[model samples]
Target: MAQPYRPDDRSECVLAFEALEGALRCLKDDIARTERRCQEVRRAYRQLIEVAASDAELPRVEPDSRLYRLTH
Candidate 1:
């Protein structure tokens, strides 16, 4: 469903156009940042897998017993 172009009101139309263009510019910036973050996550996963396969300083994850939890 589309409407016909009625440009009798020029200033208002210009303002609306500027606002929409600004919004689109901000959207593009946000999208680029998100893409970068996604790539970084992929690289981190690859590094984690490499470390796991080889001998690396793995973080110590100690499982606590019921008594240990009660004390702490």
Candidate 2:
């Protein structure tokens, strides 16, 4: 069973709603940033694939090196 909300609880409810709204905004910002980074990685992968397909001399970059860091 649940208790009914009353007028006295209105302020608390409003405060909670505001807090939730702020958190949602932050989440949206984080999602946008992640999307941009994913796009960069995808572009880099495509470039590498194209180079590999053409039987060209591959750049001697280490797999675990920072050579693939895509600049914005």
lDDT agreement with native, every candidate? 0.65, 0.70
Off by over 4 Å in 2: 1-8, 56-72
Off by over 4 Å in 1: 1-7, 55-72
Residues 16-57, candidate 1: write the lDDT tens digits: 778778889999999999999977876776566556657656
lDDT by residue (tens digit), candidate 2, 1-72: 323446478887777677778889999999999999889887987687567757757655455656444421
The worst-scoring run of ten residues by lDDT in candidate 2 lies at 63-72
State which candidate has the highest lDDT: 2
TM-score top scorer: 1
> Against the true structure, what is each candidate's TM-score?
0.64, 0.62
Candidate 2, residue 62: Cα displacement in angstroms equals: 21
| Lowest lDDT 10-residue stretch of candidate 1 | 63-72
lDDT of 1: 0.65
